[model samples]
Target: MRIFISSLISGFEQQRAAARRAVTALRHEAVMAEDFGAQPNSPQIACLRGLRESDMVVLILGEGYGFVPPGSTLSATHQEYREARETKPVLAFLQEGISPGPEQAAFIAEVQAWEGGLFRGTFRQPDDLQDGVTRALHDVTLANATGPVDERDMMTRALAMFAPENRNQVVPTMLELVVVGGPNQRILRPAEMEAPQLVEHLEQTALYGESRMFDRSLGVISGLDGSDLLLRQERGASIRLTEQGSIVVRLPLDEPRSARGFDPMSGMVLVEETVKERISIALAYVAAVLDRIDRTQRLTHLAIALRVAGADHRGWRTRAQHAANTNSIQMGHGGVQARDPINLLARRAALGLDRSALIEDLLVPLRRQYPTAN
Candidate 1:
């Protein structure tokens, strides 16, 4: 992957260097101003070209907004970010405790206010930036590998591919293989997979076959393992899923049936009301699930971070909508505006429920109302 590193040229030279080294260590190319050489073209043109060429952008912001290019409104760095957003994934890192000029502050505020799933965080030092980037890279990889699936299908498919002979032992053996693994921890133990089935499958895939279905399936499941759906941990020479893994496992999701706008036999359009009803129920289910998740969840935290920029007297539902827009978080079915779980959390906080207590004291009761979900 080619990663474009964007930041002000001054005051961030070392940080840029660190980022380049970090990207190189990951065996990915880093595209930056230094790579452009003494091009006859303007720096702004060069920067925009690099941004467009890259697969992802790592935006590092500090006190300076950098120089504005001739005939352009935004500073070069800001312009690059805005342009990159149209095509490439952006991972923004803000230097902590920097007092920016009013213009720079406004740009940073806009970034903070964005309603998309662009990853952003604060860093105090070069090392902090490197660590944050590393984590972001892992998240990007997982997201690219597989779009979200309900947990049951994720696990069932994992077992069928990894331990095919022991497919009946899906949940228990998966608990033994991946549930205990967390980020960067031991993720799988083929030996502990009940019959060495997983190891043999990989060995056979590598030795034969034009396309390795086992590898493809393992890639998606392992991506889930990295995403905290299966908490990875080192357990005495093996790895296993943590307790949270059990809570997430559910009855296998039914495959969605293909639907058409018009019925062939009747030569009539399907009832819009029926489609709307199905969507409504799904929205309710989502609301119930979100209501159970604690405030510490990333979506909730992102919403709170927006408060610092200004909540604009918006209602919680509106705020959540804006957050979903800004952060690429899925909100709900259209026309099904159930109460947002994050809003409930903010209200509970206002009522003097401690942040730590909100999940168990408030959210858990809501979860019990939807017991099957819990």
Candidate 2:
């Protein structure tokens, strides 16, 4: 139900206004769409964050004027489209005066390259945009809560398609399955085992969403647990995506940097840009994982050192050493010990997290480079 709305702050005031109204009308709980006068936060950074937490990214492609980085990707809308195409469905709400690529007859070659209706484009008038948004929400709402009756079976079918030769081809970069102790079965393995290259076992599952489920199913989320993970909900908080969806996630992987494609069986996720957009996605994920671990475990230690050394944003090593001398905890790439008072009580601790925010910046874009292995 939580959805994100994003549009060009510089060029499409009318379109952005319409979306703002539509979101209000539909009564979505969370709306993070903002207009930086079409020139906000270096354009790149702003748009990137706008698209991060969105369950469904509704972009306004009106006026066709906004800053977009060249070469790596084209057009803000196009970037959103391509990124959303592989991970989530991108809905292009064309303004009245908007133009299409070209006449079908003239672009026969271009048309052929398109595949299985990855994204959808729709046209709407100023008066009709609200109603249309409402209708779209109606469909999106049903989709988010309840999934198709055969969703599990479909995933089952997809799993069945896996073979021994493709083992590495389908391996998951991150594996999280709940190990339930039968009311009294002895608990052995700890929760969340990072990809253990040493372990050998068939980790396949018949579950739709997560391998290990926590509680009750709230609504009709048949699509998500299946091959379809992302959904557009007019009013919800967190969105769920499956490992398969992660395969389609984008990375900044392009020529110079690429995100290596993933296959659960293959167990490969690379962080090179340009090798393939898919690899970029992998790079983004790699960064996120590193960040999560660093933030949860490393940051705390580093912070301790940083504080003891006088919070001098500069000279991290010296500060770290001083902090290490104060606290006796390690810091840095190789982890060095710092003995100092990190002011650990300055902030309340979280479960390996301080707060929840977008893996924005390079994460999602890099995700674009990673490809879902065939």
User: What is the C-alpha lDDT profile of model 1 across 1-374, one tens digit per residue?
Assistant: 99999998787888998788778878889999887988778878888888888899998989998888778888988998889766666788899988999999999887765512345778998998888888777766654443333444433433332222222222211111111111111223333333344334423332233212122222222212432322122211112222222112211111123474332211111122222222232222222222233212222210110000111111122222332443332222233322222212132111121333432343333222221200
In model 2, state the lDDT of residue 330: 26
Q: Compute the lDDT for candidate 2.
A: 0.34
In TM-score terms, candidate 1 sits at 0.43
Which residue runs of candidate 1 sit more than 4 Å off their true CA positions? 115-117, 147-374
Error of 1 at 96 (Å): 0.7
| lDDT value, candidate 1, whole model | 0.46
Q: How accurate locally is residue 5 in candidate 1, as Cα lDDT from 0 to 100?
A: 97
Q: How much lDDT does each candidate structure score? A: 0.46, 0.34
Residue 48 Cα positional deviation in candidate 2, in Å, after optimal superposition: 1.0
Give the runs in model 2 whose Cα sits over 4 Å from its true position: 29-41, 63-65, 70-73, 97-121, 147-374
